[model samples]
Target chain A: AQSVTQLDSQVPVFEEAPVELRCNYSSSVSVYLFWYVQYPNQGLQLLLKYLSGSTLVKGINGFEAEFNKSQTSFHLRKPSVHISDTAEYFCAVIPVYNTDKLIFGTGTRLQVFP
Target chain B: DTAVSQTPKYLVTQMGNDKSIKCEQNLGHDTMYWYKQDSKKFLKIMFSYNNKELIINETVPNRFSPKSPDKAHLNLHINSLELGDSAVYFCASSQVVTGDNYGYTFGSGTRLTVV
Candidate 1:
């Protein structure tokens, strides 16, 4: 079974500081990667997704993630973040061939302190 | 306008009671799914329906039943709810045309609290 691992449970950062949320998946088959953000008491919103494209994928709200095939990592990055960026971020993956189901990692709470 | 919406944004019921969380989608998507988010915020897929057909049913308990009246609606009915069933349930929908950039549009979750 394909699984996603998000090592960090919580990450605290100051506003305007850069941040990186690491995500790794256990799948040798081709897969589609995605990042979703959830505000307090809100639904999950898509931040970005990596289909079959370049390694670096830019998402909304000045967030970007790089898909490293060799390392099996798709780490999300933001050069500078705002207090509004504070939310629970989830990393998800679905195998290319079997795209019916999405496996999500335990979310990482991004606490952007002002 | 909301793409996906679940009713009873907050539901509080006693144990052994039966409750249902209604979900509907206006996105004209072909696939809809139910996901459960635990207290620790770990999400796991419970059920998925595609074009009104059952596709993915995880290792969820038999007490939980999912009904799809159409491709646009997927409602979850829980019987004999237990304290462990207290969690946020999310409803999502996707078009799944080619599945290249597959992503779901989720509804504002229904927070269920079983007392």
Candidate 2:
């Protein structure tokens, strides 16, 4: 069984400032990591993913995440955030050799203040 | 164009009533899934179908039933609606079974309210 943990439930950051959302996972085998963004009253949209090769993965809207195997961490980061960036972000994981099911974290609410 | 689409964007029904939410994917993916997001915004997988075959069935109650007429369409029917069933239901599709680059494309989501 695999489980995902998102430490922060809510993160408040100012516009044009940097932000980071912490995510960690626990799995016996290799797993795929993903970040999804959910706007108000909408479904989730894939932000980025860490499959293999390169620890640093870049995604849409200038979002990026670094995968650290030792720490079992895949932290999402953005150099500069905008008001439109405010949304609920979810961190999910899928075991490589197991079922197609995805294990998701509780979610982190990002509030980008002006 | 919407890759995955779900009908009845918002549904408000009385308790003990029965309802169904339809989902269709235009991405031509082999697998489709239904997930429920509660008031706390926690997303949990309810069921998964691959090529019209039931593959994954989580701990969801027996009141929830998922039907797949074909690979492109998966519909969810609730037998007896309850207040706990009120949440945002999303339909998603994916190509890869597991591992990296295997990400899902989600629908707009259907908000179900049981009054």
For each candidate, give its TM-score against the true structure: 0.97, 0.97
Native-referenced Cα lDDT, model 2: 0.94
Residue A96 miss distance in model 1 (angstroms): 0.6
Candidate 1: stretches off by over 4 Å: B99-101
DockQ of each candidate's interface versus the true one? 0.77, 0.70
Full-model lDDT for every candidate? 0.94, 0.94
- Measured over all alpha carbons after superposition, the RMSD of each candidate to the real structure, in angstroms, is 1.1, 1.3
Per-residue lDDT of model 2, residues A1-114, tens digit only = 899999999999999999999999999899989999999888899999888899999999999999999999999999999999999999999887754688899999999999
DockQ of 2: 0.70
Model 1 CAPRI quality: medium
How well is each residue in B2-47 modelled by candidate 1, as lDDT tens digits?
8899999999999999999999999888999999999999999999
Model 2: how far residue A72 lies from native, Å: 0.2
